[model samples]
Target: MRFLLAIICCKLLRLALRLLGRGGTALPGQVALRICPDMLSRLSRGVRVAVVTGTNGKTTTCRMLEKMLRDAGEDCFANRSGSNLERGITADFVSNADIFGRPRRRLAVIECDEAAFRRVCGELAPAVCVVTNVFRDQLDRYGEVTHTLGAIREGLDRAAHATVCLNADCSLTASLAADAPDRVRFFGVDAPLGGAAAVSDAPRCIFCGAQYEYDYHTFAHLGGFRCPKCGYSRTEPDVAVVSVGALTSEGSAAEVRIDGELFDVAVGLPGGYNLYNAAAALSAATALGVERRSAVRSLAHMESGFGRMERFEIGGTRITMVLVKNPAGCDRAIDYLRSLSGECTAVFCLNDNAADGTDVSWIWDAGFERLFDAGGAELRLIVSGERADDMRLRLKYAGADEGDIRVLRSQDELLEAVTSAGGEVCILPTYTAMLPLRAALAARCGRKEFWK
Candidate 1:
């Protein structure tokens, strides 16, 4: 009876919030948990859940996997609003359940926060868990990358029966396989990405204190890495991107080897980092029993979710908004900007709000200097949000001309600059800053509200 009451209350709260024109992704779950502490565990009892957690790419990978399940004619739901906390995850499960506390869908793709994974994973008891690569993110909240790794490892300890999908390129992520050797499945890119390595979040070996040697590097510390002292090396992935064909502004084309069968995969997203995400999604999908071909084909039709490579157009200008939180994600956004052929304007919106991480010092580690060096005179810069001046100063340090950098704090000012720019514009904003800006752009472009 308590479980049923919790479901009813959650549904009612969600309805009220929707009527009030709000997303209501987290609070409903928080209130429901207060009513029934074990609400997620009860609601997720019969569901076959697939949990995706890591520093980045969780949302994108979930979307891709959800699409794959749907294309295979399986009814599945995901936490699409980007509320990854325990409360938010519970809220999504409640929303997907009937008034009697029965799940309407048996398949779930949940994106969980790394810190919250310890509390939520055991409750959900997912069938497949995908740990997208780990990096230095939310230093104030998660402390260090190793701490984040420990949190995930603890979560995996609770869900022992779940098949773990590990990133073979990320030594920190691949280390989790030690706990679940028999159930581990690996995914990564095999070819070198051909760029000088950026600042590595995991430079030293996770198993040993020794420095790692790489035969080829994809980016950051992710690649063919081996510890000379401990003999810990990247294991051959079950799913791998053997070669990258093209990385255009539209998307990427690559040849992926999935369980010994090669398939030409086209991911409808920009940047090389997405290849890792694609491989992760395919790995998770196959683990969930979806056919390999159906899973591979779904990547080409993936729609960008929320602020992750979400696109909008106003009059003559086209704007792509990407949510940047950590150094690795920021560098990938810059790489996408550098790939543009003609004149382009890049906007960086940073906020030090709790959700965006109180410590904004991670920007110093990002490869912002590459933008000025590679883009040269073809790029225009705009900085906005609560920490616009800090971004402006950071750009100055990155070799951006002081005169070319525009600081537009107001939403009207930022929107006007985007509409008047008359070319392709890429706006990279942190978590909190992305909300209002994305809503404004969605309204102007006639796109549906993010909640819808």
Candidate 2:
């Protein structure tokens, strides 16, 4: 009776919120959970589930995994709005089910928050679990990088039977396989990427306090990492990108060797980070028994999601929005902006909302200096959001000219500046700031809301 009531109430609340022009993905689930404490566990009883959680790339990994399942004639539902907490995931599961609390789709791909990973994973008992990578993120909320890793480890401790897909290149993520050695499937890049690496979130070994040695770095702290004192090293990935032939502003082309066979793969998303995401998705798909050929085919045409390198055109301007929450992610987004061809305007939006970590100090750790140094003809900078002044000051310290940096206070002013900008526009926004900017862009372009 409790389960039935929770589902009915959740559905009704979701309907009402949609009618009222709001995205109520999490609130309804929160209310439902209050009514039925075990509502998520109960509803997810008979379903085949794969939960993806980590510091970044959860949504993009879920997107590619969902496409793999759907393309192979399987019906699946996912939390597509980036509402990855316990409440939002519960809401998604409830809304996809019938009134009697039975899922219409037998399969699900869930993107989960790292902080909520332990509780949600224990409830779902997923058949497969994927951890993309971990970095220093939301220090105000999650404490430290080790705490985030411990949360994932605790979650995996509950689902002992699940197959784990991990990034072999990430020392933090690869360390999860220590306990469940036999059940882990590793994925990473095998070839060396040419360029300087970003500031590593994990410079010292988690197991041994000694500094890690890297044979080659793909980006950030991810690469062929080995702890000097403990002798902990990267395991050979079961799914590996043997070489990267082309990585442009449009997409990435690479050769992936999976299960002893090499296949050429193309990912529609841009950036070296996305190469890891593709490998993670493919590893999860294979763990779930999807054909490797079919899964690899889906990678060639995967579409970018909202605020993850999503592109739009309005009023003779092209806008690309990439969500950045932490130093590692911000640095990657800035690197992507540096890869653009013609003259472009770069907009950095920072918000101190509860969703985006209240502490705005992480901006100073990002590689804004590199972006400023790589400036080209007509390259401009615009700072907007609730903390636009803070971002402007940070850019100034990174060698950006105060005269060249324009600060726009409101969303309307930012939109107007974007529409009137004379070149391609690239936007870097924290989580909360991306929401309003996405809505305003959708309204102007007559596109559907991302959650729907």
Candidate No. with top TM-score:
1
Candidate 1, 140-201: lDDT as tens digits: 98898989999999999998789999999999999999989999999999998654475369
The lDDT of each candidate is: 0.90, 0.89
Q: How does residue 447 of candidate 2 score in lDDT? A: 87
Residue pair clashes in candidate 1: none
TM-score versus the correct structure, for each prediction: 0.98, 0.97
Worst 10 residues of 2 by lDDT: 191-200
Best by lDDT: 1
Off by over 4 Å in 1: 374-377
Model 2, range 1-452, lDDT digits (tens) per residue?
Answer: 88888999999999999999888788899999999999999989889999999988999999999999999888999988778999999999997899998889999999999989999999999999999999899789999888999999999998877999999999999999998999999999987764447536888888888999988998788899998899999999999998998888788999998878899999888887788899999999988889999999998888788889998888789989999999888878877877787689999999999989999999988878887664443578899999999999999999888999999998889988987885699999998899888888877889899766
